[model samples]
Target chain A: MRRPISLALAGLLLSASGAAAGPERVAFPAGYQDGFVRYLDVDRPDRKIKRLFYVNPAALETAKAGDPLPDGTVLIMEDHPVELDGEAPRRDAEGRFIATPEVTNVFVMEKQPGWGEAYPADTRNGDWDYAWFDAAGTLKHSDPERYAGCFNCHQSRAGRDFTFTFFKYVEDLKR
Target chain B: MGRCLALAILFSGLASAGQAAEITVGMAAADYTPATVEARVGDRLVFLNDDSVDHNVFVPTAGHAVDLGKQVPGARSELPLGKAGAFEVECVIHPDMHLQVRVVR
Candidate 1:
């Protein structure tokens, strides 16, 4: 009788554990590349979310001139989900989704001069970098002073994301 | 046998007695608060999501990287630094956010 009771208890525990498990895998579709760019909120540090952007270079250049987003870009406002511990997720606010911190990163993927087709590349090996755009959609990369200020901050993330801290979105490519 | 039981109880009590000290580092607007942190080798650093959006904390070099993948507002994360050295801390979601950790021996 005791043995039967113990077995039942064990089975119950196993079921509970299975129910609590998260998704087995997350998939990012092919034909697109993903990365992120970070910026400091000008207002206050205590109340901002780092902006995360997912991009597809193939659709770029075709975008209308002066559009806030480059072509082939899907800007998902993601925040760290408390329940998932370290995973980043998109959040919905009111009718639309707004990423906390209210900032946007501007990235352009220009083809390197000598690279031929069949070159294996992703965010890490891609010939892309970023510039910060203000709320008004002005590009800040051309300013020499701005470049240093931005590059210095991003230098830390160079190894992980070719960025400062936005590499968490590429969960599949992490080494 | 009674002596052994008492020792076991005492050991268990000790194990549960002390809560580790938790320090929260906030990443916002592209910077790490308490950017220069000083702590003993075994101390824990808790990265909090006080900002309105998500942030990712990771180390690029040879150290423990806790990819606090994406933290939403009012959330928090914790990572233990067991080795003593300077670890570069940054948010992967924000390429420009940076923080430095000075782990002392």
Candidate 2:
């Protein structure tokens, strides 16, 4: 009789664990890419410098008032490496890379309730969860530790929903 | 055909060499100039102190810790990013001074 009760308890625990398991991996929201609109272009002299940013409709709605993004807001940035032809990088009149850069990587930030609770005060970026995805939209789990750096940098923008791009998005909305 | 193939190989080698060249970031008053840098495996990061006060670049992350000591005004230090990863660098004395470095292969 004791063995039977123990077996029942184990079964219950297994089911509970399965239910509590959140997304161990998340796929790139491919549909959101097209539905979203590009709001900013950034050029950096550093690695993977040139890129464009896009936002889902929900994020823009909140940008109108310079308010924090609500839960479920998704933002994506596509990084384009400077184009190279053979051994030389193509550069233009102003010394900027000339070719149409192929999409090399995608960075994503999604605001979901209870998402950033796991991070401590020093690294938390509100409710945002960041994922570095490849051009094919496959998630790169190798650098799980680097996510903290993401939050730390964004913390400076805590006033703007922990996002540096919000002010530019708001400027575009005003026009 | 043999000569053309040899040339192709030589050029490819040079291209790879160029890809892994060093990049620089400057430390200025109150902030890291540019504040963010993109680098690659085997590339070296040269940090130049352009401010009046001293600054340091240190990473507390495990397995990737690097402390560049204190850099007085006009001083410089070079660090090679031997691996492909992203690490954050901050001045120990002034927590507000920070730089984000992303290394790719």
Candidate 3:
């Protein structure tokens, strides 16, 4: 009886395809409420900041939006390190923090990508190292080169509260 | 109390020390290397500008995104790993130049 049952089981196994687990969906932790990064021309002596904008993750939906972003939105920008003197805390006409040219990149922590989880704090340990987009809304590998472009831009904000231009989003912070 | 304070100080130092790791990812003929890397929590990735042109890096995610902006030859850029999971790095100017980095807690 045991031999007959064993034979039947083996036959069933042979007929079946190896069960392969589906792709793992990663859940990034939640993102910040709303913020924008400011880029400064650190290369100059006066620490002249080029511009300031709000980073609105929602804008991804309308990359071609014409009007200014809604409240509680963030703006993203990219640039290189600028030469300047001591840690000058400069603010723009809008009262936002000015980022130095050394600030190569900028980002806003308003929304999380639907595919992945919010960045895990314990993982990268407070470093803005990389960028990604869940194009397919799946946690699988996306384009790396595209992501690298994003990283290089954000590297300049390593210091200054680990943020490039959070001061610009003063209204967002109040929320 | 003294012992507790000392332990707190030590822990704070370790937490804020910002431990970093050097990783090379890019194409040889291309202007980048290692394009992407996987690291544990509390690690860092160093991008060395091996190419003649300048390169910028940034992320588009919440809380963990950055922009290295641009760098010239022989200049090195550093990024801190603040979270777990996969992130992308790219060059804004040379859209073709790209890389990926993964951090695990």
Per-model DockQ against the true two-chain complex? 0.02, 0.04, 0.04
Residue-level lDDT of model 2, residues B1-105, one tens digit each, is 334434533443354544765555666665875577776667677777777888867654322444566788888776767667776676755767778778777
Q: Which ten residues in a row have the lowest lDDT in candidate 3 chain B?
A: B1-10
lDDT of 2 at A146: 46
Scoring model 2 with DockQ, what do you get?
0.04
The numbered model that scores best in lDDT is 2
Residue A12 of model 2: what lDDT? 31
- Give the residue spans of candidate 2 off by over 4 A: A1-27, A84-101, B1-28, B31-49, B52-105
lDDT of 1 by residue, A1-175 (tens): 4432332232233121232111111112222223333211111113223333344433232333322223223322223212111343322221111344433444332222221111112211222223344344454344323333333443444554233322333331232
Rank all candidate structures by their lDDT, best first, as comma-separated numbers. 2, 1, 3
Q: A21-42 in candidate 2: lDDT tens per residue? A: 1123334878765798777654
TM-score of chain A of each: 0.33, 0.71, 0.25
How much lDDT does each candidate structure score? 0.41, 0.61, 0.40
- Residue-level lDDT of model 3, residues B16-98, one tens digit each, is 33454444443234445544466766665666665666666545433344556656766666665656777556554554565
Better of 2 and 3 by lDDT: 2
Instruction: Assign candidate 3 its CAPRI class.
Output: incorrect
Q: Give the TM-scores of the predictions, in the order they appear.
A: 0.36, 0.53, 0.36
Mark the regions of model 1 whose C-alpha exceeds 4 Å error after superposition: A1-175, B1-20
